[model samples]
Target chain A: MRCAEHCEVVANRPVATNQFEIEIHCPTVALHAQPGQFVQMRVQSGYEPLFSRPFSVFRRFPERGNFSVVYLVRGAFTQMLARKKPGESVFVVGPLGNRFLVAQPANQVLHLLVAGGVGAPPLYLLAEELVQTGVPRQKIVVVNGARRQDLLVCQEHFAELGVRLRTVTEDGSAGAKGKVTDALKALHGRGELSGNRCQVYTCGPTAMLEAVAKFAQKHDLPCQVSVETLMPCGLGVCLGCAVKVRTANGTDYKRACVDGPIFDATEVVWE
Target chain B: MSEVKLSVKLGPLRLQNPVLVASGTFGYGSEYADLIDLNRLGGIMVKGTTLHPRAGNPMPRMVETAAGCLNSIGLQNVGVEAFIREKLPFLRQYRCAVIVNIAGDSYEEFEQLAERLDGVEGVHALEMNISCPNQEKGGIHFGVDPEATREVVSRVRKRTRLPLIVKLSPNVTDITMTAQAAVDGGADILSLVNTFVGTAIDAKTRRFKLANITGGLSGPAIKPLALYMVWRVARAVKVPIIGMGGIMNATDAVEFLLAGASAVAVGTANYVNPHASMEILEGIEQYLREQGEKDVKHIVGTVKRCKPGNEF
Candidate 1:
């Protein structure tokens, strides 16, 4: 069973504008977590903020029993987390959601890693796993997008891992000027979008997920998109984080905390 | 030093202590089972159950407010029978009392559901929730009307021997009238107040935050309002009360007890901290010990009312 525990912060520092990397030393959570799972963390000690915020696992160092989260300053909780100093206690509950489903026989499949905003963490973590597991670095293509250049984080992290990186920004301040879907569109136009058994994996805001889902549908390709929602418990109990997805019987609301932060792009209702 | 007795009684039911995880927030007692010691709690009130399974509301079911939250879960559950078959067995192993919160669309359904769980072995009590809209009454809720509330409580009272707790909704004109009606209909206990009816809109998008348009307000924001209602009902009714609304810590639970709640249930706090009840339970013990009290029962209805300023 996954446990909710308090982990000591080793570092909580800004890596980019309005973005911070928080490293916590939690042995149990780090040892159990797989790519795509997340942790629900309490920002303050009391009821002022009143809910534990959920952040996807950025990176896990199993040998040292530590995990990192890349977060943007979006609300009070994130703002509190950003100001946290090393050695302070941060309560966390984790390996909470279902892990990213990487299809077996990784050697033959082309892994398409897509990210938006701070959503790059989990996808980048997945890329690292793919490389370590013997999937060729050339088989992985990492595409990231944001509103501007300063907001785009983790580009160099992917490069450091020797994975191919592509970037896009809505304000024309970075690589190809557009959304991540625009980069994918450009790839499709150049006939570099298909062949060799490709699959798409993405995580971001709802608008970006919808566009990625639509693009995958247009190409008739298999895709999995990680989703985000307001979750107080980060457990299936609250029934708070409901995502509507198409089932064989029609559509049903699934809890993002337990059922998935990752789901098939085709099954999502996207509204 | 002697042991401080934490046990509490509600009609024929007895709890290990006065702290319980509230309905809908605890989710069948299995979700937080690993995080906290369930046996330490006084009881576990599972999610709101119905005669049939409910699919619940649309997306954006919950949103956080300043120090509280709004939720329109629409009484989501896998129905009572499925709960018995799938969930009760797991909960039966725990030493804590397991109270099931039941909702219905009509009085008949309420009685029928009561009869179904009449002699169920593992279940300890039934909490009747009349806050849900009554389909038979053209969408008027049962808890809002005194007559409807009395009829449903009386009917269910006759169908089962289990201790009946009528959970009153605060979205009413006079909560005491509903409390009186529930007692008159033979309720053994009164659990108040359920979430207050509330809503929020996204000003920028010109859209409702919740797909349901309106949701029930919970957490610390509703505590003062809920405490007042509990006090009002305690003055009017003879039955025991399980007070809850925005109770985040032991101090809040103590406030409910001082307002005449025989027991307190931690609701929104469970979302904030999975092990909230344990901390609150310990806190209550600490308060009692510090106050030189030998029992938690000493704090019940102990609020001191101030005299008029002119008289003073």
Candidate 2:
């Protein structure tokens, strides 16, 4: 674990509604972090708020040797962080928390991914890794849903994958005019998806995850979900990020930071 | 390559390392065990306990803003008896020092709790949490008033033979005087800073983000405040000081040691990065090698003040 020292915030630009991306010039983190991990960064010039905000690594561009975080304005910490302009630097703690499991499943052919709204960051990372592994673009199908076009983030970036993008929006602002799970059903009906043979990975709102879990159960698909819990310390010491999990032996809860921000969808006991 | 061993000896107890997890940050040392390497730390300072189990405060118990976190975790530990029965044996296997942090609502409760914890085998040390703010106890008793702080430390000193380390609260106006008062009352060591009281507002709802309305803020935002207080108290006190507040890494710990801290504790850093203490321990060793220093002991109180002509 390392804290941000002289790392400068070289770029801060808004990409969506109340959502912005900040590229921090932290060479150490840019060099070390993989796809699914995140960093906790704080803004310097502000009397309005106090506390560092945790954001997932949206993308880590090795060519430029910098990593970026895409975040939404939810609390005072983020609102303040989002307001930070170019040239100002804040402290950061990284490559913190365990990352998603991307090991190639033995005898596996399909990688089904589901993402919702801005929670698409980690899954996009998984997709990027899958692309690099030479998985056929046709085998990687992304079913992403957002409230509207304003909330539908990163679809353009995913489009560049040359893979199929199936989308749904709660409001008919863009894509399919229903929910993501509804689009998932459409895929199943059209024989585009056969859940029994695929390994599913998802990241989104808890409700959407529950919906995916229900689908995994019905089809007996092996599914893993990324869940979010209240984080005071992005470190494992706080015990604030416990989530109930059911394993083959028994069921017990584990921390999101250490045990996982990612878990088997069937194992998670969402309270 | 030099092995970065985190263990150190202070007095009666040989701490596995100087990287003891801070109190209030680590729950009973058993709450999140499987996630961390308990043996890696210097010791474990379980959350502040009393004679009775407390449910603590209401939710939203925590909120993050800027470079700090605000928490109103109102001393929520499962009392002394339950700890003796359940939490104790679980921690004994870990092969690290265990410091039990105790808080009491009254002087009598303090004495009783100390008496009970006296012979607990696995309990390596006793961290006196006298700095806990009690709005109900005459508007400010143990933490704010030096008299009350001294009295509590004095009474507990008579009851327990365990090494006493009094944790001081910085909510008071003069931290030095309060520190001295605890030392005079027979405290062997001191831990500075419980959280500084703070609040975060929800402008959309026009209400407080935390249900407690105001909470104690920790993390980088309070690093300067914590550092200044540690330096201020270190100058006025003789007891070994365990400096803590916004200490997240080895550099932060170095700053504290330079300011006269004998040891340092990692608090909110645990929340942001669970592997913080180990990283800090490594960071300290890296600094020592770079500075051509052999032992970390020499760095304590080495913060050289810049003279008028010393400006380069």
What proportion of the real contacts between chains A and B does each prediction keep?
A: 0.68, 0.35
Give the 10-residue window scoring lowest on summed lDDT in candidate 1 chain A: A189-198
lDDT of 2 by residue, B1-312 (tens): 654444555655577656777887877676446456787777888878889976566555678767778777666567999998998999999987889998887899889999999989899889988776432333235877899889899999999999998988888899998899899888988888888888899899999987667778778788889889988888898777888988878999999989878788988877655566778877888888888777676777789887998778
Q: For candidate 1, what is the total of clashing residue pairs?
A: 1
Q: What DockQ, on C-alphas, does every prediction get?
A: 0.74, 0.19
For model 1, state the Cα shift of residue B54 in Å.
1.0
Tens digit per residue, CA lDDT, model 2, A112-148:
7888986788778778878888888777888878989
i-RMS values of the candidates, in order?
Answer: 1.2, 6.0
Off by over 4 Å in 2: A1-5, A8-20, A45-48, A72-90, A103-107, A244-253, B1-22, B25-60, B65-68, B72-124, B130-160, B168-312
Residue B142 Cα positional deviation in candidate 1, in Å, after optimal superposition: 0.4
Whose lDDT is greatest here?
1
Task: Score each candidate by Cα lDDT.
Answer: 0.88, 0.77
Model 2: lDDT to the true structure? 0.77
